[model samples]
Target: MAKISAAEVNKLRKATGAGMMDCKKALVEAEGDFDSAIEILRKKGQKVAAKRADRDSSEGAAIAVVNADANKGVVISLNCETDFVAKNDDFVALANDFAQLALNCTSKEELLAADYKGITVEEKL
Candidate 1:
């Protein structure tokens, strides 16, 4: 496989909104083909973000994640019904859980279907 360069990975990240490492891996897996790498990310559910697509989310708090090396990070937001809901313990916990889930999830549906606590993602949502 061809080695993917940082510039190419950054380009893919800009185009797909995926993380740097994900983009790099996808690029390497696709032999440095930008569109193919994009397809790879999409299959992994990272190319398109489903949570961000929900137009119904009008209010929420933002979240971020720093890698183990603390050199890179990702940020996201959880939309809620109100400030009171945002302040609720359950809601805060849910947001934290989903943020971690997003690190591996690419689409909203898969994220919604992921395991959480003892319940299925669908049940939690």
Candidate 2:
């Protein structure tokens, strides 16, 4: 197997938002191919998600919505690092959108991939 370089690992880490070690391992697994390493990290993220099923995600905000014209309503909350940040416009917007997508978010993993504003949930984080 070809040895991976640190610069290559860092590039993968930056592109995928994965941990340093994970990027390095993926690079090694993919034989230092950048694209393959990204795919490997993505798959690993899915595996990790299943393992985190039992973890608590009680720190997010709860948002509620009401569609008066349609006689429908919805509510959702997005967890974040702090209340102050939670109340910010961007955070509030995310929480609202997540709440609106609550019915569609089949799992935590799916929620992470769902688009919020212009970016994915992971990128927002």
Candidate 3:
């Protein structure tokens, strides 16, 4: 195995927001290749997501928003695995943004397909 330095691990951590240990392990597994390490980390996230797919996500926030005209309104629910995460400021902000997006959507499918920033609403979640 090639030597993986602390600098490389830190770099990957900053780029991916993954844990220090996870980044180091990925760098080692990828033989110090940054891109491959990112792919490895992303795959790990996917695996974890798949494993948790069946878990209940009953804790979250419901948000409602009205357009400037006051004639249009939208409401949405964003679910999370834990109350700690559900109450996070970023989580609430994202729910609000989704509600705002919902005002423009004609259906659930359109809401999911709508763009949030640069990514789709489904992808953002």
- Candidate with best TM-score: 3
Off by over 4 Å in 2: 61-76, 80-125
- TM-score of each candidate? 0.44, 0.55, 0.71
lDDT of each residue in 30-81, candidate 1, tens digit only: 9999989987887777224454455455667788876678766557677765
Give the winner by lDDT.
3
Better of 1 and 2 by TM-score: 2
Clashing pairs in 1: 45-106, 46-106
Candidate 1, superposed: residue stretches over 4 Å from native: 1-57, 70-73
Stretches of candidate 3 off by over 4 Å are 1-17, 23-41
Residue 22, model 3, lDDT: 99
Model 2 local distance difference test score: 0.75
**Candidate 2, residue 112: how far the Cα is off, in Å:** 8.3
The 0-to-1 C-alpha lDDT of every candidate, in the order given, reads 0.75, 0.75, 0.90
**Cα displacement (Å) at residue 106, model 1:** 3.7
Taking the tens digit of each residue's C-alpha lDDT, what string does model 3 give over 3-121?
99899999999877789999999999999899999889978987887899999999999998899999999889999999999989988998999998899899999999999877678
> Which is better, 2 or 3, measured by TM-score?
3
Model 3 residue 86 CA deviation (Å) reads 1.0
